[model samples]
Target: MGSRLNPYLSFRGEARQAMEFYREVFGGTLTISTFGDFGNPDPALADQVMHSQLETARGFTLMGSDTPPGMDLVVGNNITVSLSGDDADDLRGWWDRLSESGVVSVPLEKQMWGDEFGQCVDRFGIGWLVNISQPQS
Candidate 1:
């Protein structure tokens, strides 16, 4: 699939609830995964949302997750712009440029989810998330 951009919201401990609410308002299928599903054994995090997505009939794509432990969740900084798809080359190039002269919070690399993902704050302080989906075998 080609690339797409959307907003990614971060919640302290309410991602599941919030995403469900958005799904209600926007009318979409919502998929959610908890930390436990990813093998996180910590009881405190096991039930917390690791990720959630709401895709509306109008083509709106909303993603979100509960902030992991140890990450500060300041209200003003809880949202990130997500660029995601299966286009690796284009996504990697954009990741390079977007991270140049900026802070690379998470290096662009293969992640536990079997995809290449990264997070960074642009030079102007806007946050970004790039996820390059790996082709299924």
Candidate 2:
């Protein structure tokens, strides 16, 4: 699929609820995954949303997740720009440029969920998330 950009919201233990609310307002299909589904053993985080997505018929895509334990959720900085798709070369190029002279919170690499994902804050202080979807075998 071609690359797409969208907003990713972060919540302090309220991602499921917040995403659901957005789905209601936007009238779309919502998919959610909890930490437990990913084999997180922490009882406190098991039920928390690891990720949630809302895709509306109007072409709007919203993604969100609960702030993992130990991460401070600053209200104003809870939103991030997400660049995602199956285009590896394009995504990698963008990731490199976006991370240059900036803070890389998560290196661009294969992730537990099978995608090459990373998070960073650009030199302008804007947060970003890049996810390169792996091909199905």
Candidate 3:
């Protein structure tokens, strides 16, 4: 098997829910572990998702986990995951869902570069940039 790239997201306490939802959206096999499983056994965080991975049938892989103790959970400035492709409709659907309760820095619309682009900070405080190029005629 060849090496692959996947996005690893960090959440304060919503890692489980978020990863589950991604599983639903992408239809994948999901594996999750908790802090307790790793031997921390911190009663407070034992139930929180420590790590989760969703391997989708569509060949997409997404991983996420709750922020570890003392790890800073900040949003919208340092990191922005980007999605770029020519799938306009599919990418726009993602933009709609990602921006539902978040702030949009750039609305998803055709840009001067001839691609539909948008930037938003998701409700979870994760930043995202989506670029959808027009399909060739």
Candidate 4:
């Protein structure tokens, strides 16, 4: 497999719910593994998600996992997953789904740059940016 960059979110304790929610929004195959599966000696975190991945039908990838026992999960101001493409239908569909149960920071619409853009923090508190490029004149 070629090298590719994708967002990996860290959740305090809801990694499974959050990843599952993204799967529903984007329609993807979600795979989650728990710390216990990896032989985590700490029983407290045994059921926590060690890694989770959602690969969407539209060629989108989202990866996440619960914060380990020692990591400090500081919400906000650390990461934002961005989706950008020229497909208006697909991008708009994603925007609608993502914002349905979440708060929209910016409504999706045509922007000064001539593209349809929006930003929102999903129900799971993950920030997202969608930019749909306009067709050439």
Which candidate has the top score in lDDT? Answer: 4
Deviation from native of the Cα of residue 117 in model 1, angstroms: 36
Give per-residue lDDT, candidate 4, residue 122. 86
Worst 10 residues of 4 by lDDT: 69-78
Each prediction's whole-model lDDT (CA): 0.83, 0.82, 0.84, 0.89
Stretch of 10 with least lDDT, candidate 1: 18-27
For residue 105, give model 3's deviation from the true position in Å. 0.9
Model 2 stretches astray by more than 4 angstroms: 77-137
In angstroms, give how far residue 88 of model 3 lies from its true place: 1.8
For model 1, the stretches where C-alpha displacement exceeds 4 angstroms are 77-137
Relative to the unseen true structure, what is the C-alpha lDDT of residue 36 in candidate 2, on a scale of 0 to 100?
Answer: 96
Candidate 2, position 67, lDDT: 87
* Pairs that clash in candidate 4: none
Candidate 4 regions off by >4 Å?
A: none
Error of 4 at 77 (Å): 2.1
Residue range 1-137, candidate 1, lDDT tens digits = 89998777778888887777656545789999999999998999999999999998768798889989899877656567778899798778778877887799899999999999999886545577999999999
Ranking by lDDT: 4, 3, 1, 2
User: 13-52 in candidate 4: lDDT tens per residue?
Assistant: 9999999888877898999999999998899999999999
